[model samples]
Target: MSRLRTPASPAYLRVVRASAWYDLAVTAGFATPWTYALVHDALSSCGNALGLGALPELDLWQILFANLMGSVVVVWAVLRIVGPLPEHGLFDGIARALFATWQAYALAHGVSQLLWLFFGVEVTFGVLQLVPWRRGGNACRARMRNADHRSTGRSLT
Candidate 1:
């Protein structure tokens, strides 16, 4: 006698998709505010330490460039998630570079010693998240391919 197995239903898939989106949203919500606070506090402290006043009066061009850079980062992040490229593509590298730069800037500007602890944790997490793609990333690609095939009603074999 053969045992019958039931495939996941549409409702189940819906729940899974919803959960994934919810998780991503929550992560972003937390990350954005944390990042903003970290950068703002760091920059503010740096300016203060340098005797540059309460807030550094960046030129309009500088502010524009910073905004443009941030926009590029957001686009890169979205593409990294949606593109066929590995999750740890250029975006991860960019994130690592940004984190390193920020750390160096903070140190150079004499940011609060306490802030370094939070910076370290942020950098650590950023670096670790990129590891899955850096080491044996093909495994992840293969899994993604399998999922795609399954979703498209194609046989993995």
Candidate 2:
């Protein structure tokens, strides 16, 4: 059977393209600073909370090293936003950033009682993103199928 072509509205296509750009900019902008601040603040607070006398004296080198390690998260967040991943979807981008942030936190802080909080948040967001939502998978599959069918049909005709 000959396939019918459905015309896409220019406005819709523009919106879709714009969404990817926007997601890249917004996710990277927010995730980088937020991760940095959260990691630094949490560590500083934890030191005080543990009654470590003069929390500022709790090894400046270790604190700097941990913060530097945690900054690796910004790289992942940027990659998730601007790399090959589909950027039009905000949820996946956010999930990726969250996971990266948590992973960085875990790596910087090492396995400890407090690290569980970061791990839990990261795992929850990561798992939620992996879940199949209504029409989500279908839309992706349909696009791929359409492309494949078009390429094959062109060759045949």
Candidate 3:
């Protein structure tokens, strides 16, 4: 009996689309507090209240800087996801690694234990992004091999 099978979309595309959604969520989460003084102060106070220690006091410039950085991440993530380029995944993976590492270091030293949740999410998603990328690369290689065999009049099997 033959089994019915539907071809799956490329793994990298699925990953990138998911990543875009995640990035938008992160942007919304970060942008609000960084943009508003009341929210910013509340968040900073919450950190200290949670025994994570006091967050840095942000002046207007610092607040803008933080918001700007968050905006950049949002834009970059959107571009990569919309375009779904192979190299873009690698680039985002590397950036996410650095962000996760920094967050982990800070949490370990008690800089902000509250950020542990952020670190976990970032690390998890970052690794997830890379997994599909590698699979996609292998799939490409296999396709190339099959094509070469066909060109040489050899049976693909």
Candidate 4:
């Protein structure tokens, strides 16, 4: 049996791009202290409004980590936004799985309930991107087989 597989479906790739947009929009504020202050206040207000615990005050070390994470995620988001390839989704899906794991760990360790919202989105997009959705699976296999035959100077049919 041929080992190669078809690329992700167009619909799935769209979902991947959508997830990247969400990441960029949400994390962009954390990329800088100036913007993070605004985002932090907003998140705190939101959490308080919802009766969820607010994020704690961050020291320099915490701020540095937040800035690093935000910068990395923002760059990753731009990559998918520009290219939106099937492979991008696969890698992004894996990253989301890791992020979701860490998020869950934080929630269990008495982190803010606001994290639940992000956790939900992470799980959703992660699963969507992780699913195997080859474009016309059998057709792709047949096409590949035909190509192989053509290379060998033979006809598959």
Candidate 5:
């Protein structure tokens, strides 16, 4: 896909959907305390072995917040996968920026280095969705023109 393609383009829509899939795959396990405990254990063991500092014992507040975030992200990911609208890309990009910033803050505070993996993916998707891909190219122009025609009680061939 061309980096400069409009958000309305198929390429851009696919990018948005892909990000949603990534989110679903990574966060779905965090939606419940049981699953989150398992995930937490796995991460802690790996981090410790790699000298990356294991997560502290899961606290009640931590589990609550994790569950909330996981539930919200799962629903959001489902929406994007079902209907990847151009506007969704914009909003998701903004959300990614916020996530990346928070991830950075956590890293600074000595969180496990494993978080850097997620942080990198967030930054990449954030840039991909945030780039001002608007209003150019034959494909986008033709699609928009068709929509405009339909809105005006006409049809384009």
Candidate 6:
């Protein structure tokens, strides 16, 4: 079947939906504590919430820097959702993998049991994003190949 269609097509919409979920998660869930840590001198609780071992006292500048990092994630998510770049999925996958890896490291070191939840979600969603993109890309490529075959009466294969 032809993969060519408008953005409203099921496959394209699926990608957009997944991207939206990821962006929302980052914007709402991940950025909240960082914003709070910046607004208040509560870095310790933020660190604890992430299952990180006791964090050293954060200076005012450090808190600001942490919030800045959070802001970056928010901005990146927004841009990718609006633009919907093909490479965005790969970058998101990498980011989720890194988060999962860090959580696993923390769990192994006995940093906190709470990390397991984060780890599970990160790994699952990260892989889930990869699957849809792969399938979509494959379908598009197959359509292109079939088109070419029809035009030339010869298979590209």
lDDT per residue for candidate 2 within 35-74, as digits (tens), equals: 4345456565885586532123334565455455445444
Model 1 spans > 4 angstroms off: 1-54, 83-91, 111-118, 133-135, 138-157
Better of 1 and 4 by TM-score: 4
lDDT of 1 by residue, 1-157 (tens): 0110111223322322332333243234323444444555566777568665444444556455545555555554455445324433324544655766787797688654554644665465444444434544465567778989999999977
Tell me which residue pairs clash in candidate 6. Answer: none
Stronger candidate by TM-score (2 vs 6): 6
Per-candidate clash tally: 0, 0, 0, 0, 0, 0
- Which 10 consecutive positions of candidate 5 have the poorest summed lDDT? 132-141
Query: What tens digits encode model 5's per-residue C-alpha lDDT throughout 1-157?
Result: 4653678777888999999999999999999999999989988998899888788899999999999999999999999999998778888999999999999999999889989889999999998887744434355446667878989988565
| True-structure lDDT of candidate 5 | 0.87
- TM-score, predicted candidate 5 vs. hidden true structure: 0.83
Best by TM-score: 5
Worst 10 residues of 2 by lDDT: 1-10
Compare the candidates by lDDT and give the number of the best one.
Answer: 5
Q: Between which residue pairs do clashes occur in model 3?
A: none
Ranking the candidates on TM-score from highest down gives 5, 4, 3, 6, 1, 2
All models, RMSD in angstroms: 10.7, 10.0, 7.4, 6.8, 4.7, 7.4
- Where model 5 places Cα greater than 4 Å from the true spot, the runs are 1-4, 134-157
Off by over 4 Å in 4: 1-7, 133-157
Candidate achieving higher TM-score, 3 or 6 = 3
What TM-score does structure 2 among the candidates reach?
0.37
Question: What does the lDDT come to for candidate 3?
Answer: 0.65
State the displacement of the C-alpha of residue 155, model 3, in Å, after optimal TM-score superposition: 28
Against the hidden true structure, what lDDT does model 2 obtain?
A: 0.45
**Model 6, 1-157: lDDT tens per residue?**
2341432245554564565566566444335555545433443465576665444565667556656656777777776667764456556767888878878887787764545655777787677555555555665456656877999999666
TM-score of 1: 0.41
lDDT of each: 0.48, 0.45, 0.65, 0.82, 0.87, 0.59
